[model samples]
Target: MTVPSPSAQPNSLRRRLMLLAVGCTMLAMPGAFAQEVAAPATVLPANGDEIQQFCTNIADAARDQRYLLQKKDLEKLQAEVDARIAKLEERRAEYEDWLKRRNDFLKQAELGLVDIYKTMKADAAAGQLELVNPAIAAAIVMKLPPRQSSLILSEMSSDKAAVLTNIISSASDSTTSKEPS
Candidate 1:
């Protein structure tokens, strides 16, 4: 058997038949042949009066939708803020409770310390207090009896004695007036 040469006329005929078959196949498929047409664009108003009239027609509905969205956004923000405030309040309560317990412990310790300082000899007490925090030393000195305090002050350095004396006087002053007491 001999193979025939591809002729130009036969090639053109074949191509045309193939195109016709493809066209028929496309028509047979509902989607290919009947694709939805693009939506017709609405005509925009030309003049200012016509544009204003269009805007006026839809104003109330547009405003209501915008307002609704804003309201929802505000409500969400309010809820978040409220949650944060609640968390802060809980933390504040925890802090206050911890502070109260710490203060209570310190108060008991301070009383014990004051008692110990009261029992020590004035010279020894002055020596020990001088090594301690000035405010604490002053507070201890203030708690001691007048005679004991005087003895302690006499034993301490002049500068230390003066500071302690000033602290003691200031602590004792109960006047609520703005003037120096």
Candidate 2:
């Protein structure tokens, strides 16, 4: 075989050196390979409030390059948030109105019960136990605290009060028996 010329030898040496340099750079900087492998750079929108805005801009630009999301999807998400806020405000107003009406009704009913209790007591002392006993028992059931009402019923005539006491005892027993395990 013929020996290679000196000029050819130098050219070969330079080519080998260039290849070695590229290999060493690839080993030293792995990110260089990704840069070489990816597509061209893209421009992004300028307006941004923070680093997240800048990152979002870059992500949007990347997505546009990749043909991902359209503008309509972004608008739809914004509309959904707005609708949820409006619904929450409407529910808050409804709850406030319900609370006001409930308080007013409870106040009126309590006053009416107090007037009935006064009338029943007046009739009971006038020897109208027959008429007053049932009214007084009903008033005690409706107006007095549960424990106090039970005690008062226990002290009344056994024949009449026994019925109210049985009702109360049965209610209490059912409540206790229905407790969750």
- Against the hidden reference, what TM-scores do the models get? 0.37, 0.31
Q: Each candidate's lDDT (Cα)?
A: 0.67, 0.50
After superposition, which runs of candidate 2 have C-alpha atoms over 4 Å from their true positions?
1-70, 110-112, 115-143, 148-181
**Candidate No. with top lDDT:** 1
Root mean square deviation (Cα) for candidate 2:
14.2
Q: Give candidate 1's TM-score.
A: 0.37
lDDT (tens digit, per residue) of candidate 1 on 1-181:
9656445355554545445544544444446657654332244333454446545644665676678889999999999999999977876676666556545534543776889988999889889888877767877776667888899999999999988777666545443223322
Best by TM-score: 1
